[model samples]
Target chain A: MTRNVSICAMAQIKNQPAIWQHRFQGMLMECFESIMEQTQVTFDMDTGLRNVVTCSDDVFDARTISDAAVTDVVGAHFRGEEKVAQDGISALGYAMACILSGHDDLILVMGHCKESQSESRNMCTNLSFDPFYSRPLGLDYLNAAAFQARAYMEETGLTDAHLADIVVRSRQNGAHTRHARENEQVTAKEVMASPLVADPIRQMHHYPVTDWAVGFLLCCEERAHEFTDNPVRLTGFGSCMDSYFLGDRDLTAHFALKKACARAYTMAGITDPEKELDLVELNDACAYQLPLWAEGIGITGKARGPKWMEAGGMDKHHVNLSGGMLNGNPLMLGGLARAAYGFTQLQGTAGINQVTGLQRALAHGTTGAAGQHHAVLILEK
Target chain B: MTEKTTAGLVADIFATMESRVIPEGVDGITANYGYIITGPGGGQWTVCVADGRVTVVEDLVTPDVTTTCANDDWIAITLGKLDGMTAFSSGKLKVTGDMGLLVAAAGFFEKYQPPLAEITVADIFATMESRVNPDGVQGITANCGYRITGDNGGEWTVCVADGKVTVLAGIKDPDVTTTCADTDWIAITLGKLDGMTAFSSGKLKVTGNLDILSTAARFFKKYSPPSAGPEEAPEELIVLKQVLSIPQTFATGPVMGHFLNALKEKRILANQCPECQRLQIPPREVCAECVVRCKEFVQIGPEGIISTPDVAYYASPDPLTGETRETPYCSCHFLLDGCKDHETMWHELKASDIPRAERGVRVRPVWNDTLTGSVTDIKYFEIIDD
Candidate 1:
């Protein structure tokens, strides 16, 4: 009865040149086929399938009708399929819901985005807001983050150096990943010298728009053995949504992350995430979110040092080892890529960036106007 | 003079024409044109026109013709919509753009476009639909009345005729008239419910017009809210119809790849979830229940039970195929056998099967026999005995 679902097979296509010409749907199908082939799964036209969840938004121009395009790409021909209306992390949550519902055994979660095809900065206007008020004021995601980052700095006395350090370390680590985007790496001084997008947030502090697709395969214990010799069990998973309006919540604290982390820890039977988890993959779309979310997740202090170089501490819990979103953010794909990166570390397939003796890892994903929605997954080998 | 200096020198040409004032309506009259007008709060309106009468305002001392709209409305209508043409057509707008010089100057101002691009027609339609009373809401269209007392205690009754708002004569017996600050009235008209919510919260005083106030809940629906025009269609509808039209085919190498290509042939196929061990008629990446990866694909016979049946009483023209179907075409959920239990794919069923297509009825996928792995492969599934 012990089911083993390893990271049996995982693949990511990032910043590929072919995406420039081919339709995004075609690119997605190619990615899915490559993953399936690499995993060596037999194709049965009739039975033995579950659900497919796609992560995308209407704003992304690559596939104007992303949901239908994804359904067609993922082969949800006559099967149950759904698209997460929010970011990619929410799609992973939908897949998890299907698993817990006793409906299907295997689930495929995929998310991808091509920022080059659309105005990435303008995508912020699409986030849920009172159209009459916020949108008319010329407010956008960067400016909103600037307001929050300034608030956090004011509240905690954290400096721009802290953020710069994060960008430096993440880019350096990203340089080691096999699929790292070329010329994406940058140094702390270079990050600091970069032009300011908004007050308190430099251009280098934000994640870049790189075309990417990340997919994961999940299964029940019964069929888990069929896929991989060593399965990585989904020890626990939790997600929560905070107040939809940015003005309603405290900027310094991610209340959703705290609640999500608590539920995940409780389900995974871990008293201390710092002690139990060997590696951590946090969604750091902006560098300032790193320390704030760390504090929110209760991973602060010496047991596990901060991921930034300014902290001057190297603790056991390796964070953002795959460079997180800073190096290559494929919008919908960033969250799944974070989760897959965590899984790769746990499965010992994290080529150059692999952490030694990594057993348990924490994968976190966030969405919404100001990280208002959060999802935490605990994967243990 | 050089062309640039000559153009600058022509600025006073209108004054020169009027001083003759240029031999009143002489044939082939030629003169440069421009105008300057002042408004409340020292607002200045200045423009340059090549020819024709330039009416500044209606005042006898001013110009031949002057048109006016609420300044804020004028600004919003100009900056927000597609401009003067739409503004004038909507009647929320009025302009002297009809004047010859003003009409010609419209081209000069074209370079000063708004920062944001115009919203698509479909988006505007969606905005209007969401803000307006949707089709199903009851009591949303009832007639309502309201009375407002101005600051000097002068009162006026407002009647909503058809959907356009208009001032009505005062009635001794009022429907609902509550005295409130002009700010609150402005807020109410602007669609802010904070003042009203506070009124209901017992902060602001209200009296005779309580029903009218309640009816104002439909105000968002009353005004023609901003909308994307009819020209833009929802992209999803177009894609969905395209996928539905193609007949299903059964050719297969990579299941998903084959399925996408099969759309051109109109065939639909199902893949099973390996975790739940159910036959998923259409293949997918994961099972809904276990969150496990479904890598194995099995081709099940096109068939199963009708999980749900929705009969359409009206048939709108399908934009993609550009065809109008007969009314009462049935959309049903067909749960293919051997796929995940309770999982079904949606498809159209014929009118003849409507009576028999109750939930739980057995249905078999009637394939097109061409064998392309597309959803349309089996046209509509027919009711079959177990």
Candidate 2:
């Protein structure tokens, strides 16, 4: 009995002027109802059998003991509810694990964040290198990224213009995407001229903290078939955790991401990711991550190798078609939203940002201090 | 030190004064004297009196007792609804000098009962020069109470007043509520829940408010403590206190004595798990993996590589120390030189030549001149030769 798994429906609630408490529970419930109505399927009312999971970290917000609030808003009443307490993409991977465990059929995974409630910038820096060693030197995530970017440029001769192109293209795609905020547009020249937040990486290169609530309804193959005619199957999934502290790993390379991508490609029988995948919704929280991730995931051409972007190879592969974190990052929900965007693309229902005849798409998420943990999921039509 | 003498007198007076009962011949002895108590911040108070007419000064010269609690709480007590004795007993109110004067003045209130109508909220507000502004103070009022959902799906409510914490009906009795210094309460309230930091760093102390201390966390609403003036850093000295019972595990042995003695020598030591060979820093009674007693003591050197480092560009003055921690101190994880694999100690790295210090940079131990077995004996780490 070979069962297939697919994304049946998805919903996202991203409001510019919304508080955390306002959007948490109602947004999830509304998404649940909308998915049911759109798919024309009735969910179990008694058991609440649809497994639910939430992802967040204590250090990220004032709600240090936030699991209580999560359990309440997630409606875990009489259900096997769980919290990842890590990052958003890790929660998605956990939801998929629940399906693999054969415990439930339909699974709803949600991630919500409100960085506006606290001093986010300082807190973000607190998660950087050791306070005694790196902090006194004013070394934050921005500075660390600059170090890695400078190292990459020195080693690979990649220019800041290449990084600007990534921002320009991502924002251009975001302009057409529903997930993007209205009236948000940018150009390569503007991205280049943007104030240097951490030399080589300008202000436009990073994602601003946005408020969002995103949910996805995943089902087993039989159940997915009952909901929609063009069900997008989750062909493969992989994830890896690196050291919690960033100094333990090399900053120049994303080993965890590479390992995760290898696992996903092996599961999906993807020999050449650059050609096999129709689109990619990679974790481009910063602009530099694009080229670095492209090289790491074996998306680089064999002949040109490091100069994949120069060859116009990325034109065929749509990366961060939903503006990415650079456009509108919702902290805990950003990674899951990236996966949802990829799933929509594979289903041929991305709406305004739809890519025609999309068969296979890759979604990736990076978590913890400096992308220490990586998660990759492959979806096929 | 001059303020210390006045603070001592106040403490003595309060300790000996008749709290609830007044003697018949106490009328002539009841006299009001001006008081100016100051702590870290420029906290000052002036109490004025003439011929049975008691008038507290409005201008802030130096506070008689400047505490870390919300000014509204202070006003509430002055208005008579909130009991001052209860606040002091709960560790919310801190007094520094003129204990005798405070006790005598407090005694005057007991001896000659003041009319309730004389003291008003407006008077207290005028003195404090601030009106009640409830912008982000939530969860304590009638509409918003402390909501706690238990592990078994039970709901609980908590109420805090006059420095006392009470669990509402239907809520299970809390495990522990500790009464500590007001500065400690403020630190814990401001989301610094690291118990080790509070205890080992001497930022907190516990007394009668034990039950409230353990459970009733200090939740703050954007309250920043007053800045501290620069002063010479105290020379390293080890102060030995009586060994209290180790928490969690009750293993009886000389391991505790040995660890304490090691601190006296300014040596960083850890208990090695015989079975797993894991080095447990701050020597624990039980190993985290095997859950068995760690009997062997391993002397680890004070140097290692910087595992992780974070730069702090902001400063929050430590209330208890009455000094501001230098901004941009390196908070790094040092893997002790002689420890087994994956064993590291966390400490603040001295910010000298920080530009050269990176993730894999080796660091050496900088011991205090005074050696005691306490954790602070190691002072702060400095960059070392590989």
Candidate 3:
């Protein structure tokens, strides 16, 4: 059986176009203190709260060994800490892994990314591919995602209209949340009229370049009640990686996500995921990804996303109660916001965007082009 | 350089020293500066800096640093027309005494005025086009108009598109318009002025998207006016580009060394994973899947089928060299006979064969005329009929 890791408390900065007043240190200052106050958790050596995991990237931070640049705010108070170096989901996964291994109980996880710091995000993603072959082609996430969107849309008979609807709903949902980056509601017509970023992916389809800092306090079930009366338990999580080359994988289907969610399902003791999971928060980096990944993770049936959309959205199945990635979450915290929102849902603290009678929730994150690496987490009340 | 008043260049130095009442703690070590300028128009003078005060005398004194130079050269150095370090190093100015006190002498003075190097507004505006940073102006299309008010001042416009710049004498419907004085514009053009200081001082006024004006700063390298004076003349007016080459030899590890050695003999090499039975071409030290050492050097392919072909339309500049390659080049991976799935050899394809650069396309290795134990031994791969 997997160990129960409760997300006792969490805090995220108010998502802004650019936090020009403060740098990464200043943004982290309030985020760290806010989490401490929210959880009422203290870093006492006697309590055995020993490690910290920070999520950041060199390209976004524009620094070598980006995590070391913010050690004072993230790890100065801890005895042993390490950086995950991936998205927030990966760091949260590492913290949970530590707890499950019977080594550490309480772990501090912080994630921050300033999208404005990069000259071009697509160029940074281009560097992720192998230098010899893929790197020379100058393919960034937008172009690669365009190919995926076209292929996936063609295969599943999904159109640009379907994508436009997703953005409309995402922005609408974001308006009801407190810390959403894009809150103003946009109509499907407005989304469709937006300028094209790539062939199929429009400007509205893309996540706004945002500055965000989010911190979390994870305590084991043994002392979960000490932090909060109702703690949202992070029951299970699994991360899987597929081929690096885009040409090597079938972009139409989520092959890696299948493996990732399967491992999580086995650990969480979840069978018939469509009926078992109550709420779903997906790392919809683009608008098309919401419905596509929804079907990919078995939240909805294959080729049934369009039908679900036509039948008045995923209301029958609660998903992205706090908007999701289309609402301007930074690249590093793309998945972190999803997991943070999932915790709020499970804790019944998801104010206006809360789903009624919510018991279990699934939060998903993805990295690399066309979701090359996928991570899935099942959180329960 | 600002215009100054004095009877002559030699007397000018003495006059400035007379008024150069020193500040406290300036004269830590007392010294005398003696100047003996010899030329068609030459003279001598002595400057005594002691006890935080400086006094000048027409007669020479027992000095620390006895600075000697030609009258013309000394005048050039004092007027900022010639670089002081260049004059000293090139033996134009000779100093035969304590050189340490020469540096300390600068702090002993209140201020000394240098002669102005005459420059016109036309000369400053003429070089504006050449000073722009081509790379920085790339992909930007805008017209920046300038209006200079004063004698020798006129209207001008700079139209920039991508990396190309066109400067016109008259106005073009501009995005960002700037207004400044002729003196301020010339000073700014000659690097004698700071843009921010000029803006704050109300000498330079800019009206438009202030962002465009700020970006305009990046649109150009520091503008420097040409100096007609022999002392102030730069080595050249036009830029001369050169390739800085540093030869280096990198050590190839045992596995890679073996692979390159095999290439010299016109043979291919692969490393087989004992665990998965899968082979890696361009042989790796360890199998990526099995994570174990693979010492076996098995031959894989002289010919193979293209698995993934990338026909690049853009040429990303090599950051190290800043040189961009010609576009429409084909970089591909070949699925050799022994290797299946994604395990393939990464290499370039012949440009002529780019149309056929696709999956399932058969290709053969095209080796160089003379084989060397290097990765470049195989020039590229060419499409084969069968």
> Candidate 3 on B219-328: residue-level lDDT in tens?
77765434334334566554333332223223345667788999999898987778887777776555534434576878888899998999765354465765557656
**How are the candidates ranked when ordered by DockQ, highest leading?**
1, 3, 2
List the global CA lDDT of all models: 0.60, 0.61, 0.78
Query: Which candidate ranks first by DockQ, i.e. highest?
Result: 1
**Leading candidate by lDDT:** 3
Which segments of model 3 are wrong by more than 4 Å? Answer: B1-386
- The stretch of ten residues in a row with the least summed lDDT in candidate 2 chain B is B243-252
Q: Which candidate number has the best TM-score?
A: 1
Model 2: per-residue lDDT, tens digit, B1-386? 23322333332322333342344323444333333333322233344433444444434435443333334344445445466656766865665543333444444544222222222212221222122223322333321122222232222334443433344434334333232344344344444556557766655443333444333333222332222112444665654322211112111125545665787777677888889888877665545344245778888876678877776643443445534555556687778778655687878788774676688788887888988666677778888754
Per-residue CA lDDT of candidate 3, range A175-260, in tens?
A: 88888875677787888899998989999899887889999888888888888888888887988999988999988677989999
Worst 10 residues of 2 chain A by lDDT: A15-24
Candidate 2 segments whose C-alpha is farther than 4 A from its true place: A15-23, A26-29, A39-50, A128-139, A301-306, B1-386
- The per-prediction i-RMS, to one decimal, reads 12.6, 20.0, 18.9
